[model samples]
Target chain A: MDKSTKCALCPQKAVVHLKYFNRKLCKQHFSELTQDRIRKNISKNELVDKNNRVAVAVSGGKDSTTLLYSLANFAEKFPIELVGITIDEGIEGYRSESLKVVEKNYKKLGIEYKILRYENEVGKPMDEIVKKDQRLPCSYCGVFRRDLLNKAALEVDADKIATGHNLDDEVQSILMNYIRGDFSRLARTGTKTAADTGFVQRIKPLSVVPEKEIALYAMLNNFEVYWGECPYSHEAFRSEIRDTLNRWEERSPGTKYQIYNGAENLKELLKGAIGGAILFECEICGTPSPSVICKSCEMKKEVR
Target chain B: MDKSTKCALCPQKAVVHLKYFNRKLCKQHFSELTQDRIRKNISKNELVDKNNRVAVAVSGGKDSTTLLYSLANFAEKFPIELVGITIDEGIEGYRSESLKVVEKNYKKLGIEYKILRYENEVGKPMDEIVKKDQRLPCSYCGVFRRDLLNKAALEVDADKIATGHNLDDEVQSILMNYIRGDFSRLARTGTKTAADTGFVQRIKPLSVVPEKEIALYAMLNNFEVYWGECPYSHEAFRSEIRDTLNRWEERSPGTKYQIYNGAENLKELLKGAIGGAILFECEICGTPSPSVICKSCEMKKEVR
Candidate 1:
């Protein structure tokens, strides 16, 4: 409630107050703390090794943009090469604006970038795909985006692909899998990186950071970021879960952290029970999939 | 929405419409369906065995009353014996009325009944327990009730102890344990019956049935059930989860069942990963416990 409180670590005026940890910080200290937390997460999870080429999936949103900036900052200390990859889902007004923001950040940072389009890969843009059969846009978008990310990462010869999945996104995903009774997805929710044949290991450096904190970090650091909802983001069930978690976090501070941390612990205990995802080649596309054909190829065929 | 629709299985006018399954059923068919579901659950899970004496934990609430009546009907076919066990937490205006209902049902069914009081076992009532500590009444109540139930069942020489936990309660518990980051509790949630040294195996016949259906079944069966809530039923967090699940169920029917069924499936898949509850004699009471002393004994010592 007090906007002009002093920073906990220094004498400078506080710029951000974290309710979960019950701390207020000045601009300089807040940025440092944000980077430090991501650094610790990377080291704790062994997310990167010496001379590792990392591909970051940037969507121009606060989470991805913050992740890219933080990881680039982290690169100054660690021996890692960073590359930016963006998927244009072909949502008219949304994708174009976000792409501009992504391009600005990558250009300013002097990082190499690649843009993948849904139309090029799947033969249909999301806008057209939804027009044909609009039952679950997320399902189609998720499968396609994931397939393209992996493909682009492999093409770029990257060892690991990084995503801007923050604590809120991670917890929402964990709760969603639990609610949907999808055990395989639930089991893999806690891992920092996942590996399969022909699929680069995926890393989430910002998985521990809260979304609000990421947005605040972007604002404090003056990162060019676009904070717009995707036009095709109509996940009603996910929205319900997000609202439930937000309410819980409001009532009990650090609930999001607890859910994420608890999931990690459970995953460890159940590791033997929930083995790693089974890898098989998709008959149609030769992509890594549990079944004969990957989800993307199946959807692509259906959409066509 | 149509109140006068005919039963899906029969030509009789519908008495209840199940939104989840999207079917209307006559009173006779609804009752049959309810009982048949429980019967199949018991058989599928092997909740009861022939010639086994089972102790039903009755709190005089609709769930317990309905459970007792249903189990009584079930016993007519199976060769198992039934007895009722009630714990009087000493909540004034609440326990007394519920005890009358328990007594009435036990008398009508000719089932043996036993009453255990907190004052007798723990040397104080729930009211006094809360008056002293005044935090987490549910925690204290749960520990005390579970301990008393196990002790009473053992004393009555019953092989299994049955509780009135419905679908809502089961799913709430699964989600709550998950949110709390309690992996140990989450691992033990889906077992139909938990076995421990000197502890009776516990069974939940109504675990698959929803709360609303349980209430309706009690009404149709004309069981003089007490619908009063416990005076100490102020679980704020649980209430939040209940409301969240209720809203989701309203928006998408079968959400509760999906959570429960999914948990069961996951538990089966993770059985090897999550082994049975660790068993050891409690240092204070010689009861089965994973630690030096059991949770109930630990709480009793603190309460005293």
Candidate 2:
């Protein structure tokens, strides 16, 4: 271990060695740097405005837990209100334990919180839905989760919906869209916020931070972090891409950040090339969707 | 061996099984399909036009060998002239043998041929340049090769330069540029031709066909295919991406085509996003370039 190397700023023994930036940081400095990076991402993207009510999607995982904690800290400087929203996807052994972490953190932070369930909104739990249609549990879960997050944000009268999508997730998504030949999705990957009114503008504050660093920050801060995998989370394609990217990242230390930056530059360069999102009210649920009926409504019908 | 499955197009025993399309084709039909696909790509992208002279870049590999044959056949129907240009990069064992194959094919096809040497143009061969700067042999080789191709094409007065960049090469480049965050290169990947005057437009006739299919097609056509790898061809990152994509393609058929189609869609969608290329006369060489000095001229100075 290179523990003898002093921190970049102080004389403390460094705990974390960042290969990308070639900086050795101690525990205190590392945590401070992580938070500072998130603050910079938020400000650079204009994710939060003064007097804005933001709904943060907290899954009690390391990423969201870290994001919520960082945002709360940020609230001390900016005039912004944050509300915590957690979705109980009805996974028995998985979600219940993670929800406890969210509850504990929200209560301690003195933030208003809301817990929504799939059974309450979608008329069926994921456990039951997977039994009927065993093809795409992830597809069903994603559609419903996104729908609920938008609805929950609107219910709170929030101006923005924040998610714990760190750099790894964002870059993986960019690669996934490119591999799947989904050009529209590829074009829309790294935009700071959506421009539609019916949909709450989604902001990813941790988009610049790597997942490992977020986990480290969460551990350093003593937040309750759930390391459980979702029981219904099986995207084989995504897993393959993640493994490939992780291998590449291992080989080249700063690959994830390069991909993230490349994505942002591409998005900026092609802003006009990718046309505006033409959203319409879903006929059945009145949600905003490109098609006549939203994906959530279509999946709900199948589940029922 | 699945010898029991009959050919989908003919009564003869099937020699090739295309997993992507789930079709078994005999030798005769497979060759026909390969050529037809190339023809479709050419017509769809408007790669060739009437009364246009095309400089076909042939390296005596399976792809270029197959492309030359296809273009010779295509010229019979379309009122276009074909000329073959080979770049002898001065690789001792490699270029000398490949040039023989090009000579044989062009003579048999009745197409005019031209060969240029790097030592003559750049004042030094790649073999010697790699000794001095051992880091990026591929980069130096690429810059010189591209510059030579453009100059040779101009000498032949060809309206467009046709390259044998099959689906695998094109998709690999798309993923590479995306990974490296090279949006400009990504946006320019599959374009049939450039709009600049001094720069000859490039057309990739074999962009839709897979590499394996091209090799098979070359074998069926009895073309003298050079199976040697370039001595200086060591792109570790590209090799990794190629392996990953091949594994994905093996597990999921048609992944390459999807990636190719997706790249095309992305290029079209991001046309306005990636601004127009600004071309200025190079200070050292009067070539159209974005910078004051062209890449070839800069590289030539170093190589010399």
Q: State which docking tier applies to candidate 1.
A: medium
Across A1-304, the per-residue lDDT of candidate 1 in tens digits comes to: 6555999999999988889888899999998888989999999999999999999999999889988988898999989999999999989999988999999999999999899999899998989999999568888999899999988898888998999998998999999888888867766655465554447888899998888888899998888999888887788877888898999999999999999988787677666666676778899889878899888999999887
lDDT for position A195 in model 2: 55
Error of 2 at A180 (Å): 2.5
By summed lDDT, the worst window of 10 consecutive residues in model 1 chain A runs over A189-198
Every candidate's DockQ is 0.70, 0.75
TM-score of chain B as predicted in candidate 2: 0.96
| Top candidate when judged by DockQ against the true structure | 2
The digit string of per-residue lDDT tens for model 1 on B1-304 reads 6555899899998888899999999889999999998999899999988999999999888889888988999999999999889999988788877888789889999999889999989889987898999668889998899999988897898999989999899999989987898756666655365554357888889998999989988898888989888877778888999999999999999999988887787667755665666678999888888888999988998898
The number of the candidate with the highest TM-score is: 2
Of the true interface contacts, the fraction found in model 2 is 0.89
Error of 1 at B187 (Å): 2.5
